[model samples]
Target: MSEAVQIASIKDDGAIPVYVARPAAAPKGAIIVIPEIFGVNPGIRQKCDKWAANGYLAVAPDIFWRFAAGVELDPDIEAQLNQAFGYFQQYDPADGVYDIESTIRWIRQDAGAIKVGCAGYCLGGRLAYMAAARTDVDASVGYYGVMIDTMLDEAHRIANPLMLHIACEDQFVSAQAQAAVHAGLDGHPRVTLYDYPGMPHGFAAEMGDRRHAAEAELADARTEAFLAEHLA
Candidate 1:
């Protein structure tokens, strides 16, 4: 069992809903777990739970609430893909940074989170990078983040520790885009990127058919290790 709490985000001139998970015991630090474009669904909740199980306070904000609240899509492949694209059309990297910043502030004030980190998947993955670039989070991790090619210019602002997990077989983001992201890092000592073969996008999600349990476990271990290293 885990402890869950409702969090509020002050963005878009109003408040947005968020879910927070933590162990019954005190937490070591705070982590902002960004959800995919599908919104704050079950998968994201499970992620928060997993982090909590690892002894951290994990919070996931509904970035889509600014456009539509309580919006959830079907899990079918085609339907999910279509809905994800539609959601992405309404949100930009800037909006993501704004909403995540609000969540970070809220956690710092309400949860007494002394250290902050971030991790996201797919669309949320890109937003993690944006948060690392624009916010004061101590660290960030992005798993197969799309649209990284377009945000390369902002990489210079990413002064915190950053980790990126890329799928070698990803069809959406090309090799050129990956290269651009690497080049944009420009000798950032705190940043590291990894490419995993035979894994598809959203591989970290255990709820979907594409869930590679082995790869997901490996990624989760890496994430835990990264958080331990940076958040400590």
Candidate 2:
């Protein structure tokens, strides 16, 4: 139900390798899956598969292709963490937004998509928020997005539905940062924010040590239902 596809990146004119997943029947909608700093690893691919199984056309782009085209880093490896951060620091979010927008356009034209949303984990979580604010995406969901508080002012620009899952106990996101994110967008009519009481960063991702099945299931359920309602 999944295959690799190549898409053009406007920034470099290089092929951005994307993993595409198709549903057995006509899709209800489409979603662009954005991975953590770890690139399009197994967990991200599985997420795409899950979306496809849920009857949505799903694709996950290798946004880190700019530096490491197909990099998959182990979270437990110190060297890998350093390398991931190196790529993360070198990569620009604006360029990422463009790539995601490109993916959205591809979904729209090639898949005949009626409604399209985006979901991101970790670093991608922030990208999802930026995409919703800047692109034509119909909806977006972000899980434990890092550095989101710095860009909350852009929340006013979102025209479609957005759901954010904040891990309350996440070390990557401080208490003050979570409070800032909530204060900025919680009351917005188009935005919905949920707090996971004791979840950590990457809890929804099926990666080593960090995966929390119960919390992930609950959050994914909410994500699917939200996308269903907004993209229906």
Candidate 3:
């Protein structure tokens, strides 16, 4: 079983709310799980629990708390999407990276983890890459990150191990963008990219009917293996 705890973030200008999930036993490592623009919804919480089940202390910070507190998007497709995209534009990626780094530091100090990694979905996924570029994370896993192409120029500077899971049929991310990211990391031995054919943007989200069971399972296994190898 996993336990949920509330953590406070440093007040730069305001307070940030963070939710942490961990197993009863000592953690092997710590993971800073970043959430999508919808904030730390049930799906994100499940992701944290999944990580905790794998022996890592997982913490997810409310990235949108600065804009709105405890946001939960409606299940209606159009409404949910509008809310998700709306928050995405309101918060800058730099802020997300800083908040994530803060969460990482908090976990390192409170949980006493030796190594740390990051995993995120959608907007969080893109932020995962940015966190890896800016912070000292042991590993990073990005699932269908949209803005990764824009940061290709800085890819060579990334020293941490990075893994990207891309949805080949995703309308939001174009082939050109994927190519740019690949080209940027072409010779980088620390980066690995995988494309899931026919999978949508939030395929790994189990709460929705869009969940691709096989694909999600495969990605989960891959993510676990990557974290175990790097953080263990």
Candidate 4:
């Protein structure tokens, strides 16, 4: 089951709207599911629901609340797509990381969670990478995270486990960016990088035309195992 809730944010003491999903029984751990620039829509909520069903407490924060609160836009919709990008252009990753840090604290200190992991998609994927580098989150995963190669300088600060899914042919992410990400992250003991040869951005989306079922399943299985190992 899922509910809409608000959590305390360190930035300006604002309330970060969140979509929370709790397991039927006691949760084994907690996961913060970050959303794309499109906001905490159906696809993002479904992710939390799946995690909750699998016995993890899941929360997705509205990191875009400062700009647009409770906004759900479809990437496939032309007008919404442009609106989403406009919000994306204004988003600051540093702020997103702080919001993630607050979520981590709430999970551990307030929610009594033993361990916390985070999985992010698209814009969220980028935030997940930042959380891995900048927060106390125990584990982090990113699917088609954008601009990760630019922030690799912070990779040295990653103290816990991190798994990243890269869509090799992602239209939003250039081949050079992919190459840079590989060069920066490959062989990093704490980070695991997986490349999807023919996939594009949002290939693992819970819904919509972008989802590639087979590849999503493979990546999700890998993600689940990674979370289990580290969060355990």
lDDT of 3 at 19: 76
Better of 3 and 4 by TM-score: 4
Clashes of each: 0, 0, 0, 0
Q: How many backbone clashes can be found in candidate 3?
A: 0
A best-first ranking of the candidates according to their lDDT comes to 4, 2, 3, 1
Q: What is candidate 1's lDDT per residue for 144-231, written digit by digit as tens? A: 9998879888877888999999887777788788788778774778788887888877777858786889888898889889989999
Better of 2 and 4 by TM-score: 4
lDDT (0-100) at residue 125 of candidate 2? 95
Candidate 4: stretches off by over 4 Å = none
Candidate 1 is scored at a TM of 0.92
Candidates by TM-score, descending order? 4, 2, 3, 1
lDDT of 2 by residue, 91-112 (tens): 8898889899889888888789
Which wins on lDDT, candidate 2 or candidate 3?
Answer: 2
TM-score of each: 0.92, 0.96, 0.94, 0.98
**Tens-digit lDDT track for model 3 on 1-232?**
5544545554465656877888768999988888877778788888888888878788888888777878867433788879788887788788787788778777788878578999998888999899778888899999999879988877867898999999888777888987888788767899989889888788888587768899999998899899889997
Candidate 3 error regions (>4 Å): 1-11, 74-76
* Model 2 misplacement above 4 A: none
For candidate 1, the per-residue lDDT at 65 reads 78
Considering summed lDDT, which 10 consecutive residues are worst modelled in model 2?
7-16
Candidate 4 scores a C-alpha RMSD against the true structure in Å of 0.8
Model 4 lDDT per residue over 1-232, tens place: 8889888897766889999999999888999999998999999999999999999999999988987998999989999999999999998888999899988887887568579999999989999999999988999999999999889999999999999999999999999999999999997999999999999999999999999999999999999999989999
